[model samples]
Target: MARRRRKSRGRKLILAVAALCLAAVYPLQEQLTDGGGDSRGAGNAAAEDVSAAASDVFRDGSTLEVHFLDVGQGDATLIRCGEAAMLIDAGNNSWGDDVRDYLEYQSIGDLDYVIGTHPDADHIGGLDVVMEAFDCGTVIMPDYEKDTQTYTDVTDVMEEKGYELTLPQVGMVYELGEAAFTIVAPNGEYGDNANDYSVGILLEHGENRFLLTGDAEEDSEADMLDNGIDLSADVLKAAHHGSRTANTEAFLERVNPEYVVISCGEGNSYGHPHAEVLNRLREMGIKVFRTDEEGTVVATSDGAGITFNVPPSESWQAGEPKG
Candidate 1:
C-alpha cells in the first residue's frame, strides 16, 4: 500500500528510547492483537520481574501529552513528549487510514514506539497501515499469536518494512524526552486468549503516572496483581473497554486511580463501559471519561499535575446491550 501524508505541520518532538530490562525475552519470529475474553495459559512467575529502570531515574519536568482517540469501538492512544511520539494501538482494519490521518494531523510521521497491546483486532487492526506509513523505531506487542488476517496484515507489513516485533518483558523501561514508561504485565504466559496477554504499562512523567491495560480481563488482572509492580496511578485506561469482566474490584482497589478513561464506541453493541463498571468507579469517587460520549480525550501532564481537554463525567449511563 502506498504511504499517505498530509501537509507538513512542523511539530516540536522528542522521541523515546526503550530500555528492555528483560528477565526473559520472547523473540517471536511469529505471533499476533485481537482481544475479547481471557486466554488461558501460563500464569505468572516469581515476583522478580519488577526490576527498576529508566522510569525510576527520570524526572526532568518536561511536558507530556496523551491523546486517547475515539476510534468507535476500538482502542488507540498517542503519547508525545518533546519531539518523541509513541502509539499504543490503532482501531480496526477499516479505520487504518483514519488513524493515519489522525497521526498526520498531529504532524507525526515518525513514531519511536508502536505497541499493539494484544492480539485484538480492535487494538491492532490499523497498526499495519500506521506502521507502513510512518518511520517507526520499535514495535512492541505481547507474545500472543493468532491466525486471523488482521494479525497477518500487521506482521506482513512489518516484514515488508524490514522491522522486527519487540515483545515486551516486564520491568522494561523506555525514555521519552523528559518522560519514561515501564512495562508492567504479561509478566508470565497465558494460553490463547489475546486479552490476558495484553501489554500493560505504568507510564511516569515526573510525579504523574498513568496505567493502561489493553483489553486485559480478570485473569490477566490477577496475574498483574501478583507481579509485584506498583499499580497505583493518577489515571487509568479501563481494560476490556470497561467490561465488567475486567476492572475487577481487587484490580481497581490496587490501581486507585483518580481518573479513568474508557475507550469504547458510542452505543456499542458490546455494552462497553458497562453499568457495573461505571457504578464501581463512581462509587469509588473516581472521575470518568468515555470516548463514546466525549469523542476524543486528551490529557496533559507537567510531571506534577494533570489536566484533561474536557470535564470528566460522573454519569451512570451504560451502553447498548448485546441481544
Candidate 2:
C-alpha cells in the first residue's frame, strides 16, 4: 500500500549479484525470522555488527522480494517491497492456511495488491482464507467466471469484506512501495479456456524485472508477444508450471529470461516442467529453480540487482508424474 512516484527509467543494473541473473539479492527471511537487528541497543557488539551488515546490504531500506512458494502442484507467489506486499495466487484450497503461514512467517506488512490470476481452483482456492486473514488493497481477477464452490467461496468472502473484483486492462500499471508492476495478459477472450484468460503481470524493481503468467498457454503467450509490450524479463515464472503446451520456444525467446522458476509438486500428475520445456531452458543457458525440489524459493532484489536465496539446481531433471 506504500505508493511512490515512478522514478525516471534507465537505471537498469548490468546483471544481478545474480548470471544465475546479476542482482544483489539474498535470502533475508532467515534473518528476519530470527529476529534480525536487536533493537535493545548496541550492548552486544556482535548483534550491532550483524545489524550493521544487514543495513549496509539493504542500504536503500527497501527491497523487492518474490517468494515462489511450494504449495504442491499449485502456484502461490508473494511479492513484497518494504511495507507493501502483493500476492499473485495462493495455491489450492488445502493450502490456504499454509499460505497464511507463509505470509505470517515473513512478517509481511500490508498487502496492497492481491491478484487471482485466473479462477482455476489451484490458483484461487486459498484466496478466500487469505483475504479473510489479511487486509488488502486492490483485488484483481480476470473477468472469466467459473461454476465451482472454490470460486463461490472466494466471491462470498469478497462480498462479505466489501472487496470488489477489479478486472485488469492491458497496460495498466500499479505500484508497491518502490517497485512497479504492469498488467500484461488476458489480452482478449478465449472461450472456455480459463488459462488463456489468466491475468499476467510484469513487475519492475530497479534493474530487475520478473514476468509471471499464470498457466497461460501458447495462444495467450502469442497474444502477449504481439501486444508490442516488452516481454523481456530477468526472471520468468514458467507458465502452466512449465508444461509443454505453454512455454513455447518462441515465447521463451521473446522473454529471454536469465532465471526461470517452476512451481509444481514433487510428483505431480501433470508432470510439470516437462522434459521438452526443461531441455529448451537448458539449451538457452538459463538457470533453473523448482519449488518441487527447493521448497519455497525466494528472490530478493535490491533495486539495481536481484539474487535468489537458493542456487540453481544442478540436475537436468524433469518432474515425473506420480505413479
| Steric clashes per prediction | 18, 12
Please tell me which predicted candidate would have the highest lDDT against the true structure: 2
Candidate 1, residues 1-323, lDDT tens digits: the string is: 56633222331110100111111112111111111111111122221122123234331237787878777789999998877899999887767776786676555659999999987899998898899989899899988889998899899889999989899989889987788899987877677777989998899998999999999889989988998889899999999999999999999999999889999987788898888999899889987877777556767787777766555664569988655
Worst 10 residues of 1 by lDDT: 12-21
lDDT of 2 by residue, 1-323 (tens): 22112221221111111112112234544433443221212223343344345434553547787878777788999988877889999888877776775576455556799999999999998888888888888999999989999999889888988898899999999988899999999899899999999999999999899999999999999999999899999999999998998999999999999899999888899888799999999999998888777556777888777766566765768888889
Question: TM-score, each model?
Answer: 0.81, 0.83
Error of 1 at 201 (Å): 0.9
Model 2 spans > 4 angstroms off:
1-60
Q: What is the lDDT of residue 270 in candidate 1?
A: 89
Our model 2 lands, by Cα RMSD against the true structure, at 10.1
